[model samples]
Target: MSIATISTFVTAALVLVGIALALLVGTVGVAAYQFFSQNRRVRVARREPLVGYYRTLAFG
Candidate 1:
């Protein structure tokens, strides 16, 4: 085989490997974010806060 042919094959292989690595990293990042960012707190507010009320506080 010629040097040019070998170079082309190596380039293609490297590109494929790079794409796979990028996809794997992106998937892992998204999964980690979802897992670590899980919100277990109860998000329901019983009532809305009044305009001048201090006791009633609305929160997520």
Candidate 2:
């Protein structure tokens, strides 16, 4: 095969590899964000203390 033909094939393969890597990194970033956000919400909920009995429970 001619050198030019081989170079073209290599370039195409590299481009495809770059696109696949970008997609993989993007997916991982999105998943990490969701996981961290949910964890933060759970921590916040756990820290909140109950105020007291509800109005109906109070004799008044």
Ten-residue region with minimum lDDT total, candidate 2: 49-58
Q: Among these predicted structures, which one has the highest lDDT? A: 2
Candidate 2 structure quality by residue, lDDT tens digits, 1-60: 999999999999999999999999999999988866666555566664223222222353
lDDT of each: 0.64, 0.72
Estimated TM-score per prediction? Answer: 0.64, 0.70
Structure candidate 2, residue pairs in collision:
none
Native-vs-model 1 lDDT? 0.64
Q: Model 1: per-residue lDDT, tens digit, 1-60?
A: 999999999999999999999999999999977753452122123243333232332231
Report the lDDT of model 2 for residue 60: 38
Question: Which structure among the candidates has the greatest TM-score?
Answer: 2
